[model samples]
Target: MRKALALSLCAVLLGGCASNPADRDISGTWINQVAIDAAAKGGPLREALQAYGPNLEWDVNTKAAQARYTNGFENVEGKLLGEKPGAWAVDFYGSSATELKRDGKQLSQAASENEPEQVFDRAVIPVPEGAPIGASFERALYSAYMGGSWQVVSGNGEGNTVQFQADGQVTGLPGADRYALCLAGDCASMSGGNDSIWLQQGGQGNSWIFARKGKTLEIFQSVNTALADEMPSYTAGDRKWLLEKQ
Candidate 1:
């Protein structure tokens, strides 16, 4: 495989580098360009997919965000995003350090020119040897990168920030009909201060409070109604859910 040798080198570099939730610094958007490049045959990631972001938009194939630790390694043991598993019972790793473009969301860590090349393992990925590195590969990589990624987001350490990632776009509940239609293909908003953001699938009733603790984003959903589960339940968590970003 074109990237197999690259993957080996990345592992050698990342040895003994367990991530500290305190060391993560993912503010905006980040991408595994290796994965992204492998996926696109049409054009650049955003142009090929017709997606852009300040509030980055990602699909099953596109990783919406990531966290770059000071040591350049991200661990995805219990994260809510991206879920993929394969041979070797692998918990993957990437450069803890990364550079983001002023305009593009693609990450520039471990690129071909970097001191230590950016690479990942095919063996860690549970796919048939040499699966076509296309759309399916991108989505698979997303699950791999994000699923095991982290529940941490970068912040000012003020512990007053609120960052929530929609599990299914729009709260998907019975009351989200009023609060900004945040869907999988679109964008959403976050609130600040003592104010509670109104979220629901219908006439806006589910109130939510957000807080940041170091690398973790916490959402306390004040579900005054019974439509909670349908209202954007985490793919695998609860109301007092932990969030991640990069």
Candidate 2:
């Protein structure tokens, strides 16, 4: 009888070890924060605002929560969690469908209902296949003014550069209001100086320093000649025409 009891106890223990299903319910309004990992490829936010549509709402409390229309189709809500800056997870939820886990273990049926659900999608934005990830603001300015085919000519000693095209075409290097100067050796010297420079084609250039933190680039400059008058001046309303990375 002792041996029979031992066998029965082993069977019960094995039965208890079997895996159970998840029981967590994620149907409530969860507040989280979100950082801008990647800017949207299109001008959807601006278009939405201009069209008088529902603007994308980000959680004010959490630094990793965002809600926006995905590809002009379904509205996607994303949540990211991690201590490090870049590491994050996203959850894509449809209007009526149940939330799904993207990269985490599911809970057992006996799990508490208050347990947080694992994020479903890892990436914040669904990038198209073969899309370039990031671009500098200066590079973006080049492409916007000189078309997508323009190439960087050279980086002058100051915070200026020239760009050109293949067919012996010369395009002006557009100026930036606020320039983040990655100075060589000592960036401290360049800091707090409000100087500006003149770009003249085939002529000596002049120097001027930046004054404010958020100054706008008024005109395109070239070391060879003053291209400010040649190039079109961008205005506040022209910000809508800025190029976006896909």
Candidate 3:
């Protein structure tokens, strides 16, 4: 019973943050900014976030919060337990509760005595549009196959590194911060049953597609998504793009 209670506590805590009062409503989209910035500089936390997937996001409403991950999302409806010394206490499962404190656009969650508090900020979330057919399965495969570090083999930025996260987050890729299994509604027919991935500058910036081999990734400049026939290939000169799993 104690183990089950502990698991329930973890589930509720990971679910998200919540609050009431219009002036202090902790509603909207929230992302772990600290984890993201730390992951970019490379360290133990980076590796951990990479393995855990960096696109962790939360959608908090007045009385509920939803935590989104690569595999999926979980929602936890909170009940107003009571008022704490400096925050609002919300109970998710019996005695397991989280305290929420909101200030402006930022929301802070009080942690246990040994754990550091977590902070989240209000932010806009980009919507992925034109999802291709079989995107779910393709996304799952992409997440499973691309979750690791890759070393650039022959690109202009040789010796650099890139990490493909299961949650669509990409790190150490020049001009790209996110990735997708398929976007622009053109990947299904273009892939020809082969594994492919897309790298985007920002969520809405220019994107390039790459075909994946066993342990190698190759990008063709001419096959960009801007044009219908655009597909990445092993081109010469500056367009020579390749990555090998490290």
Candidate 4:
């Protein structure tokens, strides 16, 4: 604790006031709060970072960060999560999806009238033989609502078709914002019928909640415990997917 304080103070005095990227961690959201905060308060580092004052979001599972720049349309935008202060500049556009694990034949969670749910056998979410899974599956739905050009950066995970535009943006995908990242470390399974996935985040001093259902997956979020966004973390929401093996 003392060492961290000293480092912060030394950097501030040096007139650079920056954290090293090599030592940065991703345990929370992508925003470099330490640096951005300094900038927002009109410190020496404000020019380069420009005070990240957008509706920020990200996926902890994939470590992808998104920043919604509102120059014109409020449809949402994407940007890579930065590692440190000085490196916190917009690279092209980027986003990410969340992930899962495996358990047995009991309802992973309960479904309520307010929250719809579905159940899969064993612990595998079945997608069409050629659909998508794992990281690839994550790609199809990641920060999709927070706009950006979507690209299938890797291979197939669970498998379902991901139709893309000539420019690589996804089309005819699930509901616009139907996705989630399990707040509890490495999640394994999701149950069905009014059953929703869980995500816990309260970065902006307000707890946000939302829900969506895909043709195969459904996601929603509801919680009271406020979460912080100091590292690579995610907000509260749900992501429901299928497990039909092709």
Candidate 5:
């Protein structure tokens, strides 16, 4: 009897396992749409479609959905429709999508054909206080050439400072013998040998200076020179250095 009971349990477990595969829900389609703003301008909708490749996915409801540029449609499973309800509206720059609505009703035909459509998610990073204004010219320079962490080596009340690190790093001063000079309320400048470094002083007195070397812009720390130059350029720009409050 125990042997029989054990066999029955095994069979039950196998049956449950067998049913799980069929229960899997792979029911969704990739939804593509055009930015209302872009569509209005008669710009190539293909540009908007290409931008969503990473964030968009289609399920195996029919076959793989391909975004086609020729038809100016998202081409989910190769179905075409007008700007009806159930159609998706895309924002290329934001990488997001919204459902189309006409009057008060969603286009039933489009929505029905493309059931279970996936919408792309959009992410935004807000500008922090003390962010550099205008062209990131100064920030770009520091990101390209200056290696290692750039800490504020020395600075007077005005703004002139020397930032150095243990990894044979020097930034701020431009030209061979020229040093960085910051005039408290005015502008900051760096001369490296013969090269002139561009300095952008924020309203708060925190400064971002960079020397132009070819196409790269090396970054330096405004206050913490010990921080490695390996820090991401965007992160460096986002940093709130301890300078005079704006």
Candidate 6:
């Protein structure tokens, strides 16, 4: 009887294992409609998205993940860990782990312990791959080129200091604490192709445009802010402020 009981227990365990669902494969570009919708209603994130353009795309595969923002110039990569529980997790090295729960065609991420979950929908249309040279402008390249303390080299804000943080925060630049770079655009040209780095201080309708360079940062204050309505344009003459990485 004891031998028969052991056999029954082993069968039950095997049955439970067989009933478990297979690990899901989440590999595609995801657009954050939750953030976009929230921005349309008005908020700090909205203002930032407006200035930077709401084109944040998450591209992931079985092993790697990337957060492409503002025309894909500001790109951040994370490691794609296999599915855990019912969700797939992306580990951003030392920063954070983003767990995405898939439901049909949508993936949802909890905004916080209390806030409503943010939703990401798989993109039917993917972001363009950009120019042939685009591959050279990865996040690591830009981070190494721009990250750290900087001092105004020659232009308007000469002698002033600023910082380009690894986490996207900008320090010491007046009326701005965050930055986004736009290098390419979608087929519709709705979000990017501005070829400018946008900076937002706080509140709606307030922003700054800076031309990105190798070691120097150029600010174009004279450029008309009204251009935010259409394609933004700025000439070399508009750039009078500069900062050199220290």
Q: Total clashing residue pairs per candidate?
A: 21, 30, 4, 38, 31, 0
Clashes of 4: 38
Q: Which segments of candidate 5 are over 4 A away from where they belong?
A: 17-19, 30-246
TM-score of each: 0.19, 0.19, 0.39, 0.16, 0.19, 0.38
User: What is the C-alpha lDDT profile of model 4 across 90-171, one tens digit per residue?
Assistant: 3334433111111222211123333222222221223344532222222322323213322222223324434422212344
Against the true structure, candidate 5 has what lDDT?
0.29
TM-score of 4: 0.16
Among these predictions, the greatest lDDT belongs to: 3
Mark the regions of model 1 whose C-alpha exceeds 4 Å error after superposition.
1-184, 187-214, 222-239, 242-246
**Per-residue lDDT of candidate 5, residues 136-173 (tens digit):** 21122222223333333233222434443212234443
The lowest-lDDT stretch of 10 consecutive residues in candidate 1 is: 53-62
Evaluated at residue 139, the lDDT of candidate 1 is 39
Which is the leading candidate under TM-score?
Answer: 3
lDDT of 6 by residue, 1-246 (tens): 999999999999999886234335456666655444443332233243344333345566764444332224346567766777777776667866667667777766645443345566665432236522123222322354356678978664578788876445677766677775443443113322233555776643233455445556666653443365766444323565678766
Residues 1-246, candidate 1: write the lDDT tens digits: 769989987897776475442233223323334533332332222232223211121111113333322111112321113322211111125423323222222322332232343332222224344433232333343342222223323322322223222221232223343332121121122221222334555343655554434344354654333255543322211445455543
Once fitted onto the true fold, the runs of candidate 4 whose alpha carbons sit more than 4 angstroms away are 1-133, 145-179, 182-191, 194-210, 213-246
Model 6 misses residue 71 by how many Å?
6.9
**Alpha-carbon lDDT of model 6:** 0.53
Q: Which candidate model has the greater TM-score, 3 or 6?
A: 3
Q: CA lDDT of each candidate?
A: 0.32, 0.27, 0.53, 0.29, 0.29, 0.53
